[model samples]
Target: MLKTESLPVLMLMGPTASGKTQLAMDLYDSFPIEIISVDSALIYQGMDIGTAKPTSAEQAAYPHHLIDILSPSETYSAAEFVTDARKLIKDTHHKGKIPLLVGGTMLYFKALLEGLSPLPKADEHLRAQILEKALEQGWPALHGFLKQVDPKTAQRLHENDGQRISRALEVYYLTDKPLSLLQEEKGPCWDYPTLQFALLPEDRGWLHERIARRFELMLEQGFIAEVESLMRRGDLSIDMPSMRSVGYRQAWEYLEGKCDKETFIFKGIAATRQLAKRQITWLRSWQGARLIDCQRSQSLSQRVILDLRSQIEKYPIFM
Candidate 1:
């Protein structure tokens, strides 16, 4: 049996359609590892087809934690993810298994690794007021206001990204402190030994092709019907976080007559590629993460397992 203290938390990160799920399953078959999903979309129930969530049979064979635990209407933040992941990591360790956190959500990984700033909680009144001002002056105007107060963060975010822009302004409104300064003050909370791996395709063109193909396959697999089912419920809207997921957003817009069929497919594929691009950018910024070329000829699972064994051998607790 492997010693509990010798096992490290394994983080498997990659862009969408980079074969992260397949590699994670291979690792699960080869080792005593429990999976904790790190994806934002997978947490919501009934968001299966669009999110490309694990099938019922796959989930049955290899149970994953923190997936399908929330309704689409409910909100989940990076802070909540940190709390849930930390608890799951401890639990998995106690059960003599290494926690294998797998997904493409870089924000969650960052929050779990580096602790969040002690910013004040979301204020509904303030949020509403901001939204009202945004409706009148537009998000770009609000972004300009943010640039005056927190230029560092404003430079990092896009003018169209209302969610983050509002949050940064909210922090300034509540605490009179820049969001960047608060984030810098906080230290990493997770001190345990961790082995981080990122799956990156050497050829960017090849990865883009893969993303387009995968999205087409999703549409063939009743993706539009899935979105229609959610829409018929009347409780969900395109503005909601769940519906705002890349492919889902395009599909929702198409169904609402905002776009034509051809445009919908093109937009969906383009959005997925953009999401992958953003994920790759985040992975590049991460320090000390081992990069796995997804295009390699050798079996990725075997290579990863061998690396894990080597790491275990060097661990002091194993000696």
Candidate 2:
């Protein structure tokens, strides 16, 4: 367990393709910091090109925790992320290294910082029943039902967000209460000092262009082949959480003859931009976090290090 005197944990968060990985590596080179990934997509093994996972050389030089730890068929929940992150943070602190968490998974970050409600474990039978209903009536129909019961959560979630939608409905069915309300009742689980930083692009158009270029690079690196390899496993499908990721989903559909190459490229780029938009929304609403505009400045890693050093000087706990 992390004691009150442990050094503060540092979190570096940004949208997809925002150069967070490079910044984290620079920080590790300069400071005694160990990184723990907060990304949900990077957890699955064999998901590299689309996820833009760190290269094998990069991982060897600057190791990261919680990456490539699960099979594509396995499911990872925010609650489980909280448990795993806490343990990693504790272990890193014990080794006298600052815990630096980096990634784009906003929900995992929220669950880690704010804690989770005391909800019951997922009942697979109930979940299967809900999925069956979704298959019959469609997920949009289920979203409509969720709106009637938990309008707030429904409004927060996208109509096509099958995993979250099913979880919300399952909570309502089991407890007759709202998941949001239960979440509000919970307090932060780990209260040791912490610092959070968000990287935002001042020019939205520039970020969009970057997203497009990166997707093209992924394609050049055989992203389609990566998806095809996963599909050849005979155990994965588009419905699984891993396949539902931004670029992978579009690739899977295109491979299945659902769309042409032009449509696939367009959808993949659009999906990545949509994800960045949502991440920006979350960053805007986050309190007590410093926002760094990536477009306005160069050498973000040095800037972050200076800021962190300032904090460490003021609060020895950060040291």
Residue-level lDDT of model 1, residues 67-157, one tens digit each, is 9999888888898898899889888988777799999999999988888877778998999999999999999999998989999999999
Scored against the true structure, residue 137 in model 1 reaches a CA lDDT of 96
Clash pairs of candidate 1? none
TM-scores for all candidates: the values are 0.83, 0.83
TM accuracy, model 2: 0.83
lDDT of 1 at 208: 89
Candidate 2 lDDT, tens digit per residue, 1-319? 6463446889999898888998899989878889999999999999999999999999999999999999999998898899899889988888878899999999999998888886767899999999999999999999999999999899999998999999999998998998777767664566878899999998889899889999999999999999999999999989999999999999999999999999999999999999999999999999878999877557787889898887767644435
Each model's lDDT comes to 0.89, 0.90
